[model samples]
Target chain A: MDWIAADWGTTHLRLWEIDADGGVSKRLDSDQGMGVLDPSDYEPTLLGLLRNRLPEGRATRILACGMVGARQGWIEAPYSAVPIAPLAATRAVKAPTRDPRLDVHVLPGLSQAEPADVMRGEEMRIAGVFASEPGFDGVICLPGLHTIWVQVSAGEVVSFRTCMTGELLGMLSERSVLRLSVGSTGWDANAFAEGLDRGLSRPEALSSSLFTLRAESLLRDLGPEASRARLTGLLIGTELASVRPYWLGQDVRVVGEPDMAEAYSRALESQGVAPKILDSEEMTLAGFRAAHEALAAHAH
Target chain B: MDWIAADWGTTHLRLWEIDADGGVSKRLDSDQGMGVLDPSDYEPTLLGLLRNRLPEGRATRILACGMVGARQGWIEAPYSAVPIAPLAATRAVKAPTRDPRLDVHVLPGLSQAEPADVMRGEEMRIAGVFASEPGFDGVICLPGLHTIWVQVSAGEVVSFRTCMTGELLGMLSERSVLRLSVGSTGWDANAFAEGLDRGLSRPEALSSSLFTLRAESLLRDLGPEASRARLTGLLIGTELASVRPYWLGQDVRVVGEPDMAEAYSRALESQGVAPKILDSEEMTLAGFRAAHEALAAHAH
Candidate 1:
């Protein structure tokens, strides 16, 4: 029988149908996000989208990940603890749906110890990354709104830390007072590196440093984009100050979107460390498949 | 001759009319603020309000301070250095309006040497604060959205540092994902202190700590107010880290609104230092008034 796997996040959603051997044959997209969506709407929306993707008379079992397990998602499959492997959450539930042969299961998310953070879809990808290479002991950094630094040892997540770097940058650029002082787009690698340096040097002064963009623009006539760069430098530099303690003198691996992967690696490079990149998409997909296998065993 | 001095901020507008002796013969208030008014409407609205307030057929000189002098306001005046003195931004203009005799002057702001930040109306206030305490030595702390810590020596506004303490708290309390985690009202002193301590201790971890509030509320039931306190603690504590180093082992003076003064003093106390509170309103007004007197020398 064919099966389906989904990765639903805050801003978007993606679904894929996998054959019995785990090869993806069909895929789907929708705006029905779990971010603002009501828990009750999860099944109907997923099934609605799922029905459209399948051929006539096709029987399918489905596994879903991402925010579909968050507080606002379907059934609220709460997050679990460290060494939190794929299928770590308690046995998956065969979500009751209107279509008799359509089996839907939501995967439980993963959490880490020390610094203390959690992840959902990525855990699957980490498992997938590890599936390709067993006994991988190192740090896997997932960069995004919530940048997670997951420590894996002996094939399990040991500990992690979360940084709202992207979210902070977004809020400052789009929603906060800094919004008044920044431009839409520009890149200055030198300015970015300068900011990274400052963040590492005097991190405590971060919040106050944010207002400097406005002051410098008004006082020194620093152009808007330059002021924007200064702001980014200030925040990134400050983050480096705190996180550098854990990451410095260590080998790091990044598993995320390409651009983000580059930025994350560059951030590590500023501290004189090198970081490798892994496939974030595959990380989540492999995690969902791991859960799928676990579910199959329970059914048998 | 009659004159007017106005200190208009984001939420409110305050104007003081002075006689030759600098005595307040009249005062006016309105909801017209740069935060609320359209940039294009400032001239018409300001003139309309002032014209109505003037004695019939009488002319009065007007001076403006605060955000009204920002880019969106009457005119963009640049920032000056600290000890910018009362008369610094003295190229006061006769704002073009239907009434030709009405002269409006916009005060240029001041920037500090340490911590690299700037201020507008508060500059005049810092002057006044220094003038009032002629021979004071130590740090004078101004608490607000951007908290300024000014160091004074020999009756001069030496240098200062700005902390985005208040703004960060407002963001966490109102706009962040933690908003729901923290209830609307109720300020927990314990939580506030915790935040101050944490902020002071590991300020770099702040962006991540903010998200932890949400993670925690989901993990365990953080009572509405406690969660609020945690968010508050996170912000203030972060600021304490920034400001404490300067005040530690040194006497610090607290300025501004009383509650704000109290918060600063408390943050200082956590660092084993006691702070003295001063009248921030009186400081700013006196600063402006001093600036007015210094400017009056050239007016005649």
Candidate 2:
């Protein structure tokens, strides 16, 4: 029994075909991102991509994740309340028939809490990571466009908080007036660390601190690297203020690319808490595999 | 001799027909904004707009202020260093035009310490505000897109600092990730004050605190009004950090809108300081007049 996993995100579609043991055998990606596709069109897109990878007359159980199960996705999956981690056993949605020998299941992401944040794609990876490890109880942070902090207890996503830290950094650096100050290049790590620390220390002044990026550039003749760091710190500082409580009693595990984790790590460390780093892709695949096995078990 | 005064900015051309006694009889404005006009083309645009505004066939000494003297304006006026305010005696660049009918002099905006931070339009206003009240040696604050803090001494802009407070607020509220959490309409003033105080208190952490806006919204159910306040404080707090040095041992004057002044006033008040509020328009107009006199005297 081979397994197929798809992380259909807003801007990119990533699918991997794996063995029953969650070993990656083949992978394919498409520009037909979730952001580009209509809710009604998700079925054909997923089916077409999965069936393309798996030959006709081969009945393979496929698990799909991400915002694809959103209100506008292939099928609407209601939210799971806080402290109730998204379950491994998701209801199979009725997907369109594009191939004869395919059984598709679109895994629903969890919507927990008001101002109402949701997660689909990453929740799968979170669950999978928890399954692979023992005594995994507490917060797992997945950093991206919308960074998520999952409160896991007994392998469930009981409660989670979403922070759009990356998106804010991008907009401020690339589009806003601060764009002129950051210069053209990768961020300066020192400035980034300092900024992150500054921001976390002073959570209330978050808004005004952003302006100081350009001001510092003009007045102090600070380099682009420092300005970039200032911005990162400003946004992260605000994030710390809100999530400080979550980090107080729980063990924080951070899973993401190294560059991002660098800042979050420093932010947490400054507060006297050290985060456990995990391989981003490995956890993603593990989560995908866990979901596939759960679906298979339910069918029997 | 009738004196001509102009407020030539990045976007619009505003001209005043002033009697020798410094009374304005005619006010004319046009769509010729400094932002869109090229430096070489600025002279032509000014001449074109001034066609009917001036006395027919009479040589009028025209004095202009603002961005008309930036690198892209009618004349390239170099910036004066910080610790020195934009003065009536500040350098005036020659507008490139063959028509002797227009004795045009464009006042230069000051930029100190670097080539990146320069303000062309309001320098004269800062000068005028200081000159009008002699012995007003202190920190004068002019808040806007780039809030200017000028150290005025003997009626001159001695030194200044530029803060990107307003611009950052607009960028974050409109473009940043915080946009998701902040509800734009009907801000909470109390929340703003609270944010301002929190920001100023943790001035060093100004850089990192911005993310709290989104985090509180997601993790702690922080509302838009509170988020808005948090954003404001973040920027304000950073500004306070940079401006605090100049703020001490000086009588302060603020030249801006009342509400913004109130915010500043409260921030200062909390620190046991009170600021004098001046009319922004009056200062600008008076500054323009003073610049005109200086230019006329130089010709004499």
Give the best candidate by lDDT. Answer: 1
Clashes of each: 16, 55
Fnat, one value per model: 0.46, 0.16
lDDT string, candidate 2, A6-80, tens digits:
777767888888876657888889888766788667767766766556665776666777766665566655545
Best-fitting candidate, measured by TM-score? Answer: 1
Instruction: For residues A1-300, write the lDDT of model 1, one tens digit per residue.
Output: 378888888767898888878877777789888777887677778768766665457557777777877766776676778765556634454455666557677777876544446676666667776766677777878777777777778777777777777777777788676777787677667767777777777687687677766666655666667766666667766766766645777767788887667766787887788888777777767767766777777768
What is the C-alpha RMSD, rounded to one decimal, of candidate 2?
Answer: 5.3
Model 2: per-residue Cα lDDT at residue A225: 74
Native-to-model Cα distance after best TM-score fit, residue B47 in candidate 1, in Å: 3.6
The DockQ assigned to candidate 1 is 0.54
Candidate 2, residues B1-300: lDDT per residue as tens digits?
A: 397778888668888878978888778888788767776676677667667665668667777887787655677766676656466353776666667677777777776542235577777668667557867777888887678777777655666667767766787789765787887865676777777776666654332356556555755678887787667755675677657766765688888866677667666766777888888767877887777767667768
In model 1, which runs have C-alpha deviations exceeding 4 angstroms? Answer: A55-59, A112-116, A224-230, B10-12, B16-31, B35-40, B86-94, B112-116
User: How does each model score on TM-score?
Assistant: 0.90, 0.75
